[model samples]
Target: MTHFDVMRRLTGPLAALMVVALAGCSAGSREGDPIPAPSTSSTAPTPSTVPAVPPAPTVAPTATLPPPPLDPLTPRPSGANTPKVVNVTGTVTAGVESGCLLLEGYLLVNAPTSLVYEGVRVKATLEVRPDLVSTCQQGTPAMITSAQRL
Candidate 1:
């Protein structure tokens, strides 16, 4: 036979063998599916001696998270609508609450008035009301309704 004819004869048998092998390999490519095998007896196969597989779990998983933390402890009054009061010494300066009171070491407290000079030093007993909207240097507001020079 010619060289081309010899190659053709081999190709037919090789192609058939490849198709059969591919068919066998594809039988078990899917997950959770049994691979088929040749069986001789017509009777059903006996159960394996291996232990039985337990059923899949039915309960769903749960996620638990801790409660959010509490807010910072603020200086609150004994009752509602009660104003915070304090007595501090500082130089008079302009502030949002009006004439701002500047303590030697403390943050500025609003004292808003022209009667006190820009840099006058004084010791004052002041009644500071709780201001929800005032933005002084400190977190609180001090309204010095009464004052006396030291």
Candidate 2:
């Protein structure tokens, strides 16, 4: 064949192959690549470009009963006289300081070791004893006369 005839035949096939290869590469890149965000003069991000976040689920309000009154009683003049006592019923919880127990804001004192555990509901007879020295560092100190799990 003449030089011109050979050149023309080669160019047509080579151009068609190049176009096919470029189309395939462009399609793959379009699928894999993330779209570039539009540039803005303002530093603040555009609201449209930001993703929408779902709102948190609403929780129901819990009803809380008021804590019982813990008024201190008058100290007995003599050991022969009986001290005043009040009954308190509530759940036992751990104090912020270690080895301390509390019931309805009353620092439990003179309670049995077995009953000093946390989270146990109990019916207890307490005597407000503000005169006694305490190291529990929390709640009104009350002496437990009798206690039983409820």
Q: Pick the candidate with the highest TM-score.
A: 2
Question: How do the residues 1-150 of candidate 1 rate in per-residue lDDT, one tens digit apiece?
Answer: 899999999999999999999997877545544754555576754577556889998986687775343222354445644555578777765444454445543333434355455577777766554343344554354455556665
lDDT of each: 0.57, 0.78
Model 1 segments more than 4 A misplaced: 1-81, 93-101, 104-112, 137-139
Write one digit per residue (lDDT tens) for candidate 2, span 1-150: 999999998999999999999996676434346764446568876999889999999998799875444333434446533555789889999888888899998888766778657999999999777655678888888888789998
Which residue ranges in model 2 land beyond 4 Å of their true spot? 1-83
- Which predicted model would earn the best lDDT? 2
TM-score: model 1 vs. ground truth: 0.32
Provide the TM-score for each candidate, comma-separated: 0.32, 0.45
RMSD of each: 13.8, 16.8
Q: What is the lDDT of residue 112 in candidate 2?
A: 78
